[model samples]
Each structure stands twice: as C-alpha cells, then as structure tokens.
Target: MARPIWSGILSFGLVSVPVSLYAATEDHTVHFRQIQRGTSDRVRNLRVNERTGKEVAFGDIVKGFETAEGEYVVVEPEELDQISPGRSKTIEISGFVDLDQVEPIFFDKTYYLGPKGKEYAKVYTLLQKALEQSNRAGIALFSMRGKEYLTAVRADRGILTAHTMHFADEVRDPHREIGNLPESGTTVSDRELTMAEQLIDMLAVDWNPDDYKDTFEEKVHELIAAKQAGQEFEAPSAAPRPSNVIDLMDVLSRSLESAGRPAGADADAGGGSEAGAEDEGAGKPRKRASAGRKKAPAEDLSELTKAELYRRASELDIPHRSTMTRDELQAALEQAAVPARHLRAAS
Candidate 1:
C-alpha cells in the first residue's frame, strides 16, 4: 500500500468524515541528470546571493513578494501557514452541483481520497453513493502545502475521488489570447461536410486506454539501449503534411476508402461501415480490399507518409506490419501491389 500524502476531515453540514488522500497518477517519463558536455563531470545548480556571490543555505532562504514600488516583502513559510484558509486539515463542502456543469478545462490534478479507517467507512460509503446516484460533485475548499485549492470530490468506481480545480480567473479567454483562430463565417460545401463526417464515422473508435502506450517513451528506452551497445538507430519518419484545401473532398473520400469503406457510398445515406468495430477484435489481421481491383502505381508509394504507408499495409493484410519501420512498410506495400499490376499486364 502507498503512504497517504494527506490526512484530513471532510465536513458537510455538521457531518465529518476522516479521509486520506493518495496520488492517483505516476510519472513514467525518462529523466536525466545534468552533465558537462564531452566529459563525465557532473553539472549542478547552487543557490547563491547575486550581490555577495556566496552560496546560500536552504534554511536561510525566505520567500519574497515584489511590490509595484520596487521593494520586496520577505515572508516566512510559517507565516503563510498561519494565514491559510483551512489550516491544512479540514475540507468543507459548500454544496453539490451537477458534475457535467464543470468544464474539463477547470479540472487539474486528481487524488484518490479514501476513508482514514474502517470506523469512518459508513459515512464515506454513504457520501459516495449519494454523489454516484445524483451524478454530482461536492464543491469544497481546502488548504495544503501552504496554498488554498478549490476542489471537486465525486464517486469514482465505488470510491471517493477528488480533482483540484483551477479558479475562473486562471483560465484564459482563447478569443482574446489567440490570433489565428478561424472566423465564425468560415464555410465548407455541404458535400464536403457530409464526406468529412462520413470519414470520421468510419474511423471512430472505442475509448480504451489499455489499447495505447506512450510510443515516444518506448523510443527513448530503445535509444538508451542502442547507445549503451554503441549501435546506430534509425531516424524517425517525417510527420504527415496537411491536406490541400482544394482536394479536401478527395482526401476525405480516400481516407474512407482506406478504412475499408467504398469511395462511392451514397453521401446522403450516412455512408460508413462497421470497420472500426472490426479493429476492436484485436490480434487478428484486418480484411484486405478486393484483390481483383487494380491498385495505385508503385512509384507513388514513396510520396506517402509513414501513416499512409501503414494504412496501405493494413489494407493489404501484410504480416508483421506493426513491427515494421516506415521504409519497410513502404516496401511491403509496394510488394503487395505487384500481383495486381501483373494481373493487369497479363490480361
């Protein structure tokens, strides 16, 4: 079991439930130490006074707030603690509101909030059930680490969970902050809109976190292993380019066809297939396009991005496609195209 990061009382309307908070996530990203270039010597950062050029001890440092008049007010950590809203112990729930009413942008870090002891289990379960049935979250204010946080507590998988929230002022207005946002009057043809929607429908997938991994993290591990063995690693493929505005419809049509839907499907008929559903039955290879149909020219394969090449390989049902590099995928796709080309020439 993990140690609780916080232990506090959760109070609402004279009822108090003691709870322990645990971190809900972990950082698996690769981290590195600072080292001097071309040497094994370590590089380190030290806190020093700019005026005296002397290293400062940790205990001697104090927080400073710069004022508009060019003076700084030095404060101690104990003073900040004394002025905290809840004094780092109590979380007072003000009220409950519909969970969906809170925008996603307002949510921040999450914590697994569990009852402190078996004695408090009944009250904790009661609140969890109430929040679960009502589909609402309890809004609360709490102090921790010398700072006050607005948080939302709710039922998650039969237990209590809490998410620290951003205050309204902290969230910026995108309309004011951003410059390149599309105009409200930007328009596309009805046919293009329908085809785009159709393409989206064909590629829609179920939300399963287990189905994906951090590929870049895996690549980093691979890189470390290669460097340790003094071996060369292949460079990453170039990113796919943006589609041409003039060929938007054509791009949509091609995307749908690549995902196993026919290009000529009726636009008004909500044209899509259960292709995405087929992918969920994992480990089995995808069904290929009709073999009798002539394929695109082989030389054109070089122009396509790795993603496009991978899609072509999937359509051809090439073996070991997942493990293939970008160049290997293109080669597999070109090899698959040869039989179709031969049939056309033999005829």
Candidate 2:
C-alpha cells in the first residue's frame, strides 16, 4: 500500500475537515543505472570541487545562485528554511470557478484527498457532492515540503481529487512560438465534404480507455519472456514511413473509405461516418474535428444516412468528391485543407 504524502485539514469556507493526501498514480517505466561499458561495473556519481579537483562532502555542499559570469553566491540550508513558508497544515480554499474554465494545460499532478478520520468523513463527502452539483472546482493554495503550491480540488465520484497547477507565467503563448499561421480562406466543395462525413461515421465509437494498450511495453515484456525461455524471437516489424498527402480532398475521401463507410453516405456531414477516420499513421489531431468546419448532424455514425453524411461534410469544409470511388472519396476527405491546432500525440 502507498503511504500518505501529506496530512492536513481541508478548509472549505467555515468548515474544517481533517484529510490526508496520497499520490493518485505511479509510473512503472524501467530505468537503467550508469555503468562501465565493457566491464559492466556500476558507476557512482560523486560531487567534486572544480578548482581543487577533490571530492566534496554533503555537509560542505550548499545551494548557490549565479548572479554573474563565473560567480556564484552560496546560501546555507538554514537560510533557505528561514525564507520558506513554515508548515501550517491547512489547505485553504480561496474560491470556486466553473471546472470547464480551467484549462487542461494548467494541471500538473493529481492526488487523492481522503478524510483523516471518521469524524471528518461526512463533511469530506459533502464537499465532494457539493462541488459536483455546482460543476465547479475549488481553487486553493497549500504549503507542502516547504514549497507553496496552487491547487485545484474537485469531486470525482465520491472522492475529492486535488491537482497541482502551473502558475500563469509558466504557460507559453502558442501563437508566439508557432510563428506564421494559415488563414481559413481555403475553399472546399460540397461533394468532398459529404464523403468525409460518411468516413467519420464508419470510424465512430465510444471512448473507452480499456481498448487502448501500451504496445511498446507489451512487446518488451514478450521479448523478455522469449529470452527467459531460451527461444529465439524476431524483432518487431518496423512501421511504414508517413506518406506525404498531396491532395487534401482525395485524402479525406480515401480516409472515409478506409473507415468502412459508404463513399457517398451523408455527403453534407463531410466525407465519412460519425467516428471520423483515425489513421494510426496520420496522427489524431483535435483540430480535424473541434476546430474544423463543423460536426455532422448525427452524434453517431450508426444514426446517419448517406444524404446526411454528404451534408455534414459540406458543413465541415472538406472537399474533392467528383470522379472518385468510395475508397478514393474517403482518402480525399481525410486530406482536406484545415488550420493547425495544438493537440496531444500518443507515442
């Protein structure tokens, strides 16, 4: 069992509930120790003085700030402690805001907050339910391990989850970093959009995290098993290199076809079915749907008709449908011209 990282009282307005904070997750990735290459001997990292070329004791080590070139001002640990906020043992909530307004980028690490004792359990649960009903998250600040952290606390199921947040200044402006961006003046035809909508419908499915797996980790375990069994195992096949999509319309149309949707189904929707074409080769981009033209009328592809698909595609601004089979139509819809937006990439 994991240990509680923090013991404190959760101050919700006038209510004070004793609670403990525990890490909500763990990463099981493998790590390697540095060693001598040929001898396979372990290597130890040692602190040394640059000018004297002598090993430094832990007691002699002090934190320093470099104010100028080749110069550093050393500060004692006690001096740092004097400046740091002392332990007060209370997570003070300042205000509550609509949870939707909290940007995902600002979230850092999540922790489980549980009542410290039975006396406080009722109030703890009450706070969680209240937050859920209000659709709001509590903004709070707490000092932990001598450092101050801004946190967001929200109700998840029957439990309260607190997530550390990044300061406003830490987030970078994407527009400044990405440089020049394209305008939305590019035109797309109705027919091409229709095919794309149909393709999306065919690929649509409910989002269930259980369906995904870390293939790389699985492969590593399989290789280890084979080696332990004294059996020879071939290396996994390399994935195909990404092919540059030259024609957006053709790509969207082909993508629709690949999704197993009828090429011309609901042309208005864009090109494919409800579940848009998700090519593992072509990364899943949030812009392809949310920031694109618009969603097809049907929430699910199973509910959509061929005519509706075509209409949705037109709304979505995907193009290039004439003189193409169902397969070609799907591909073309996937390649439709669209603006770039920030999205997470699964490795």
Candidate 3:
C-alpha cells in the first residue's frame, strides 16, 4: 500500500473531517546516474560559494534576501517565520465550482484523500457524495513543506481526490508561441478534415485507465532478462512506412474502414473493447527516429530507403552513429523502433 505523506483535518464552514493525503502519481521513466565517460566515476554535486569560489559547509549557510544595492538581509529560522506565518494545519475549502469548468492546465499534483479513522468516515462520505451530486469540486487552500497550495477536491469512486492547481499565470499562453504561424485553414481541406474525423471516430473509446500498460518499460525489463541469460541480441530493423502516402484522406479512409466504424457516428458510441485497455495511462505521444537513422516518410518501416534510414536515425537523435558499423546502427535503431511498434500493435 502507498504510504500517506500527511495527516490533517479538512475544514470548511462548520464541518471538519480528519483525513490523510498520499501521492497519487509517480514517475516511471528510466533514470541514470551522471558519470565520467572514461573512468565511469559517479558524479557528485558540490556546494560552492559563488563569491569566494570555495566549498561551503551546510551548517554555515544562511538564507538571505537582497533588499538594496550591495546589501542583503540575512534571516534566521525564527525571524523568517515572522514575515509570513502561513497556515499549515488546515485544508480549508472556500468555494465550489463545476468540475468541468476547471481546465486540465490548472491541475498540478494529485493526492488521494482518505478518512483518518472510522469516526471521520461519515463526514468524508457526506462530502464526497455532496460534491458528486452537485458535479462540483471544492476549492481549498493548504500549506505543506513550507509552501501554500490551492487545491481542488472532487468525488472520484466514493473518495475525495485532491489536486493541487497552478495559478493562472503559471500556464503559458499557447497562442503566444503559435500566434505567428499561417492559418491552418489554408492547409486543411474539407475532404481531409472529414477523413481525419472518420479516423478519430474509428479510434475513439470511453476513458478506462485500467487498459493502459507501459510496454516500453516491459520491453526494457524483457531485454534485461534476455541479456542476463546471455541470449544473442538480434539486430533491430526499422518498421517500414509507405514512402508516398498517396493522400492523407486515403489512409484515414482505410483506418476508419479497418475500425468498422461509420464516419458519421460518435467516436465513442460503441460500448467498449478490452483489447487496448491495459495501455491507458502508460501510452505516450509518438517519437521520431534518431538523428543518424533515416526517417521513413510514412509511419511504416518497409517504405524507408538507406538514405532515409540515416535521416530517421538522425531525427531520432541516436548517438554514436558516425563510427558505428551497420550492425551497431541496427541495434541502436531497435531502441527507437520498439516503443513505436508496441504502440501501433497494441492500439
């Protein structure tokens, strides 16, 4: 079971429920330690003073704020508390709003909120059901780890799920970056749009998180097991894509036909399929090939040329391509190909 990180009362109006919070998500991406290339020595970060160019002892460090030219106000722990004595005990709900009205962009970290004891279960269930019936989320403020956070509490499967939120200023305006681009209207035709919609309909399904799996992680573990068993490594090949996608509409039409869905029906109308359910949360966006390998114009691998293979590999940003032999290149290319193959196959 996941451990609760904090325990406190969720207070609002005249009601208070003792509750505990546990992290709702975790990072699964592979991580590696920094090391020196030649000696493979693990790198260690050091604390050094910028002004004196000398290493500083943690005990000697003091927090300070610069207030004027060449001047700083050193602050002690007790003194710092006098400046801003933020509330650390309460998760105080101030208001409620429709859950849909809160955009996904505002969501930050998520936490699972559970009743601290049987005594609090009644109120917890009451709050959860109330929020569910109203289809609303509670806006609350809480302090943790010395920082204050605004959070939303909503009913999910009979429990109150709390999500920390980003301030309006934190979400960057997508328009600012894409503002100068030419209008997409000129590039998209009505036929292409219709086909695209059809393709989307073909792939549509209700959100069922249980279906997702981390195939890449699974493949990595499998490869590790094979390596441990001293199995011979087979050279990897790039899956071929059609060199010329005659027309985007054609592919969309084929995809829709393959899915057995009519173009006009709602994308998610069909009941449900369990085939790809395991891949729900673990699936990520598509990736490009390495810089050294040639890219296939289409997503399939058979349509690639030797030159395109080089380009695709390069686009994927694979390393050590310049001096690598064909066999080595193929092995490197496999790393990029496997995840994509799994996504397409699983989907």
Candidate 4:
C-alpha cells in the first residue's frame, strides 16, 4: 500500500466525508544518468555564486523576486509559508456539472480519493454512487502543498477520483500556435465522405488498453540487456514516411479496399489447404495492386513479401499481427482469406 499524499474532508452542501488523496498514476519511463565520456564518473550539478564562483550552501538559498530595476527581493521560506494556502483540511465542492462539459485539455493530474477511516466509508460510497449515477463531476477548490487548485471530483469505478485542472487563462488559443489548418468553409463530396466512413467502419475494433504495448520502452530494455552482455546493439531501420495524399477519393477507395472482409463470415471459404501447401513450398513473392485479402482479385499470396502479408493481415484486422514473424503472418493471412473470399462471394 502507498501512503496518501493528502488528507482532507470532502464537503458538499451539508455533507462532509473524510478522505485521503493517493496518486492515481506513476511514471515508468527509463532514466539515464549524465556521465563523462570515456569515464565512469557521474556528472554533478552545483549551486554557485556567479561573482565569487563558490558553491553555495543549501541553508543560504532563499526565494528571490526580481524587481524592474534588476534587484532581487530576498524572501525567507517561513515568510512564504505565512502567505501560503495554509493546508486547508477541506475540499469544498462548489457545484456539479456534466463530466462531458469539462474539456479534456483542462485536466492535469489525477488522484484517487479514499475514505480516511472506516467510519467515513458509508458517506464516501454514497457520494461516489451519487456522482456515478448522475454522470456528473463536482467542481471543487483543493488546497494542498502550499497551493490551491481548481479540481474536478468524479466517480471512477466504485471510488471517487480528483483531477487537478488548469484555469481558463492557462489554456492558449490553438489558432495562434497552429498554421495551415483546413479552411472553415472547406467541404468534401458526399461520395468521398461516404467512402471514408465505410473505411472507418471496416477498420473499427473494440477498445482494449491491453492490446497496446510500449514498444520504445521494450527496445530500451533490450538495448540495456545487450550492453550488459557485452554485445553491440544495431538500431532498427526507420519506416519510410508516407507520401502526401494528393487524391482524396483515391486514398479513400484504397483504404476501403484494404479493410478486407466484414465481421462474421465462414473462415474456410478460400482454398486453405492449397494456400498452406504453397506457403510451405516457399515460392517467389509477388506485389499486389492493393494490400488486402479480397481487394486484389488476381493477386497470388505465395508471391507476396512478408511486409505485404503483414499489411494484408492489418487490413483483415488480425490481432497481434505486429509481433508475428513472416511465416506466422503468412499463415494468419491464409486463415483470414477464407472469410474475406466468402464475403466477396456473398457481395
């Protein structure tokens, strides 16, 4: 169990629930230490006086506010503490609003709010259930660690969660920073729009967070393991950047073709046995007009490269195709082709 970062009473109207705030997430990114080249010594950072070139003691450090005249007003930590939010023990809920009403950009860090003691559990659970049923979040002011934050408290699963938010002034206008955005009056033809929608529908799948992996982190760990074993690490080749799309209709049409068969059909319509035998024979690869199971009607699978096979598998919505070997992809594609061909026949 982790220690709570904050403990306070969550108050709304006449109700008050004693709660403890625990960090809802953690950073798992790999970190590296700065070291001198050709030496094992770690680099050190020191706070020093610019004029005297002498390292300053930690006790000498003080908060300084620079004036317009280039003079700093030295302030003691105790003096700053006096003006701090004063660690208010209450998170006062101002009001409740629909969760969707809050823009995603305003949200910052999240913290889980648990009942501080068993005596408070019933009230805590009641608040959580109310928020969940209402599909709304409570907007509140929370003072912690010398600062006050505008926060949103909502029910996540069976518990209450709080997310710190940025004030309106902190968010900038996107138009000022971004250029070359599509014109407001720009429009697409109905046919093109329909085709794009079809492509999206064909490629759609259920959301599963577990399906995603941190490939960069995995590679970093692999590199570290190789270095520890006294082996040289060769970087993987970078993928080619896609060329800009000049023809919207062409792109949409190709995308639809690549999206293979629709869900739910016979999985053995195509000549599966023949495809497997041909794959075993290891014949010369061929390039198809479009990288999809059913799109390239006259294309031969035995002639396609591993990259082409993977692309076809992707269009067919094969799970975990990214980590599959060339042989594995080919086999998967063969199995996928059955339903794809069946759908084509029905169509």
Candidate 5:
C-alpha cells in the first residue's frame, strides 16, 4: 500500500470522517542531466551568497518576503511554520455544487482520499454514494503542508477523489488578455451550419484514450537507442502548420467527401457507412480532393518564386528548410518527389 501524504478529518454538517490523502498520479517524464558538450563532467547548481560570493549550506538558508517599500522581511522556517495553517486538520466542506458547475481550468492537482480506519469506512462510503447519486461535488477548504487550498471532493468509482482548485481571484479573465474575439451576435448561415454539422458527424468517434500515445517521447527514446548503438542518424523534420482556409464551404465539402460521406447530408442521418476507423492521421486535408477538382500537375521549380518554393518545401517536410537557398530547396523537393518504388529498387 502507498503511504498517505496527509491525515485529516473530513467534516460536513454534523458528521466527521477520518481520512488519509494519497497522490492519485505520478510523473513518468524522461529526465536529463546537464553536462559539458565534450566532457563527461555533469553541471551542478549551487546556492551562493551574493555579497560573499561563496556557496551557502542548506541549513543556513532563510526565507525572505519582499515588501512594497523595497525591503525584505527575513524570516526563519520555524517562524513561518508557527503562523501556518497547520493546526487545522479538517477538510471543512462549505457547500455542495453540481460537478459541471466547476470549470476544468480551475483544477490543479488530484489526490485520492481513503478512510483512515475500518470504523470510518461506513461514513466514507455514505458520502461517496450520496455524491455519486446527486452528481455533485463538495467544495471544501483544506490545509496541508503549511498552506491552505480550495479543493473539490468528488466520488469516482466508489472512491473519494480530491482536486486542488484555484481561488476565484487567482483565475484571470480571458477577455482581458485576448483581443478581437468574434462577436457573440455574429450569425452563421443555416446551409453552412448544416454542412459543418455533417462534416463533424462524419469525423466523430468514441473516446478511447488508450488509442493515443506520445509519439514525440517515443521518437526521443528511439534517438537515445540509436546513439547508444553508435549509429549515425538525422533528426526527423518537423511538420509545417497548415495555412488558414480561405474557402470554408469548399474545405468542409472536401472533408465530408474524404470521410466517405456525402456533403450537405442531413444532420439526423447516420455517418458514412464506408467511413474507416478514426486514427491520429485521419481528417487531414488531402491534395487529391481539393474542392472536388482534379489535382494540378507539380509546378515547375524554375518558374516558382522563393516564397512559393519555401511553402512547397514546408509541405514536403524538408529538413533545415529555414537555412536552405531557393535553388537548394527546389533540388531537395525534386529529389523527394522521386517515386518511392524507384528509390526502393535503386537501394
């Protein structure tokens, strides 16, 4: 069994249940150490005194809170702990609210709550069942590790889960930060809206998180393995971002057709019968189906401008493209445009 990070009483109304909090998630990201380029010597960080220009011991460190008057109030760890919200070992539930009422942006970390002892299991189960039936979460204030937090306690699969949430004032208004948002009163044509819905229906699939994997992480591991084997390899080229669509209706029509669905189909009708299983690579714009017109022949590299050539190079996933000259880009594109079968036979 995993050890609990905190032990506290969950109090609401007249009932109090003793519970223990355990972290619900763990980090699995790959970590690297800083080192000199040519030498095996690892880089190390040190805490040094600015005036003395000497390294400081961990025990000698003190906390300082900067004041508005440009002065720091130097404080010891013990002094701060004395005034901390440490004495309150209770998660006091202030209100109950629908789970949907809470925005996901406000949530931070998640932890699992379990009954401290077998005796408290009944009350714990009672709260869990009540919250599950009501589709509501308990908003509470909890103090842990010398700090107080706003938290939401919700039931998940018969277990109590607590999520730390940002205070109302801590969340910034998006409207204040962003500019030129679409007007709320702006209207969409019924025809365009119906076609967009049909396109969406053609692309919709059941949510299965297991179907996705971090490809970048997988590539990093591959690179590490190749380096360990003393094999020379070039880094994969980055995919270019698609340009903004100038023709929304044309794009939507192509999307529906590519998904094997008829454009402007009734929203009430089921999706395309010929539609393949949705994958990560699905729904991308294909060159062959642009506006239901036949694909034009590849442009003459000698006739195209530098910017046009750069755009084509980007589309072809050329490496070191930002540094490539116009002629070099054209040559690279021509080399890449060679038939795959011919290249394979030559190899």
Candidate 6:
C-alpha cells in the first residue's frame, strides 16, 4: 500500500472525519543526469557567487521580487509562512459547490483521501456517497511544502480525491495574453460548417483511455534499448502535412473520404468561393463571406498583447516602449499606424 503524505481531519459542517491524503498520480517519464561532453565526468550544479567566485550557503539566499529591471525586494521564508493560509495538519472543507460550476482549468494536482483508520471508515464512506449522489465537490484548503493550496475534493471510485486549484488571478485573460485570435464576428460558409460537423459526427467515439498509448515514450525506450545493444533504431513514418487556406477544403474532404464518408453535393457546395482563399498569409487583406462588408479602418490595437505592441513599436521606431504600460503601448501602436493608413487612403 502507498504511504500517506498527510493525515488530517476533513471538516464537514459540524462533523469531522479523520482522513489521510496520498498522491493520486505518478510520473513515468525517463530522467537523466548531466554529464560533461566528450567525457564520462558527471556534471553537478552548486550555489556559487558570480561576483566573489565563492560558494554560498543555502541559508544565505533570500527570495527576490523584481519590480523593475535589475531590481528586487528581498523577502524571507518566515515572512511568507506568516502570511500563508491554512494549517499544515488539517485539510478543512470550507464549503460545497456544484462540480460542473468549477472550470476544468482551475483544477491541478490530484491526491487520494482515505480514512485514517478503519474506525473512521463509516463517516468517510457517508461523505463519499453524499458527494457522489449530490454531484458536488467540497472546496478545501491545506498547507503543504510551506504553501497553502486551494483544493476541490470529489468522490472517486469509493474514495475521496482532492485536486489543487489555481486562483482566479492565476488564470490568465486570453485577450491580454494571446494574439491573432479570430474575432467573434468571423464568418464561415454554411456548406463548410456542415461538412466539418459531418466529419466530426463520422469520427466521434466513446473516450476509452485504454485505447491510447504514448507512442513517443515507447519509441524513446526503443531508442535507449537499441543503442545499448549497439544497433540502429528504425525511424517512424513521416507525419501528415499541415493544412493551409488553399488545401483546407480538399484536406477536409479527403479526411471524410478516409473515414468512409464520400464528399457529396452538400460537401462540394460553395467549394470555389473567394472567402476560402482570403488571408493566405499575414499582411494580406482578409475577405468575408459577404463581399459588401468593408474592412475595419485599422487593426484592433487592444486585441494585441503588450509584447506584440512593443515589437510593433520597435518596428516603427517609436520611443520609450520599454517603460510603457499596456494601455500606453496600445495608444502608441495606434498613433504609429496612422501614416500608413493615410498613405493607403491617398493611393
């Protein structure tokens, strides 16, 4: 049996059940040690001072938070521990929430929660059954490795499982982080959409994890075995090419055909439309399904990330982009694009 990593009382309303937390998952990836090139000498890392060329003791190091370039606020481990939430011994359930209400992205590492002793088994089983039948997860908190984690506990296979979760601030805003995402109003032809749906329907299957295997990991093991035996490892076949604007429809049609669904009238409808060829690559004017829809005057600067705006500022030879905030970057980017828009209008 696996050893428990933590033992605590799981608080449920006025009732408390003694439980043990064990890791629910294990990594199977291969690990390797560092070695110097052209020799069998094992390489090791040590804490050495760059300025003094002397080794620094672990106790001498302090946490640094950078507020600006080459600037940091020094912090101590005890200071952080003083502010950390939850106690080390107890995994306390604060409340219960509908499981579906919690987004999948928020959930992180999983741990199994078992009754600490057979005497507490009744309470554990009762809580497990309640959670399962009600389809709710218990929101909990516990400290581990000097940090408190927000967690969700749900019943799984007659046992309770807790998953560490990201706070709301940790989940990034896509509009702020990502670039070049399609606008909500972007349109596609009905024929293309219908064919895509049909293809999905043809390929849909019940998810059975046993049906899949990590082929790359398998090949890695094969390579190591072959090299150990002094034999050449055979390479796998080349992967399929990526689809582009010109070949997208053809690729989709062929994919349907390969799945035993022939491309009939509905699939071929609007096959020659100019909308399919628009925006073949960047800097080209994109077209819409409706030919009458005019292009927007300029790119939505708000949609671009700060780094993208900084890159644009660099390209346009704009000043002081390094010190600018996201809003300032957007404003500068908007100002820089004005001349080009005017020149295009004049032409």
TM-score top scorer: 1
What lDDT does candidate 2 reach at residue 334? 45
Tens digits of per-residue lDDT, candidate 4, 282-336, equal 3422222244534323345887665566567654556555446667767777766
The lDDT leader among the candidates is: 1
* lDDT of every model, 2 decimals: 0.79, 0.69, 0.67, 0.73, 0.72, 0.74
34-144: candidate 3 lDDT, tens digit per residue: 999999699989899988889999998888889998799987765544444534656889999998888998999889999988988889999999999999999988877
After superposition, the stretches of candidate 2 with alpha carbons farther than 4 Å from their true spots are 57-60, 75-88, 184-197, 223-245, 263-347
Q: Find the number of clashing residue pairs for candidate 1.
A: 0
Model 6 regions lying over 4 Å from their true place? 49-86, 263-347
After superposing candidate 5, which stretches have Cα over 4 Å from the reference? Answer: 68-70, 78-88, 185-188, 232-237, 262-347
lDDT of 5 by residue, 242-328 (tens): 745567656666665565543333222232221221221344332321233322234467987555665565445454544466577
TM-score per candidate: 0.76, 0.68, 0.63, 0.71, 0.70, 0.69
Model 4 Cα RMSD, Å? 10.7
Which wins on TM-score, candidate 1 or candidate 4?
1
lDDT by residue (203-245, candidate 6, tens digit) is: 5545778989888889999999999999999999999767786
On residues 274-341, what C-alpha lDDT tens digit does candidate 1 reach at each position?
A: 23213321433235445543354657777876566656665555655545666787787787778877
Question: By descending TM-score, how would the candidates be arranged?
Answer: 1, 4, 5, 6, 2, 3
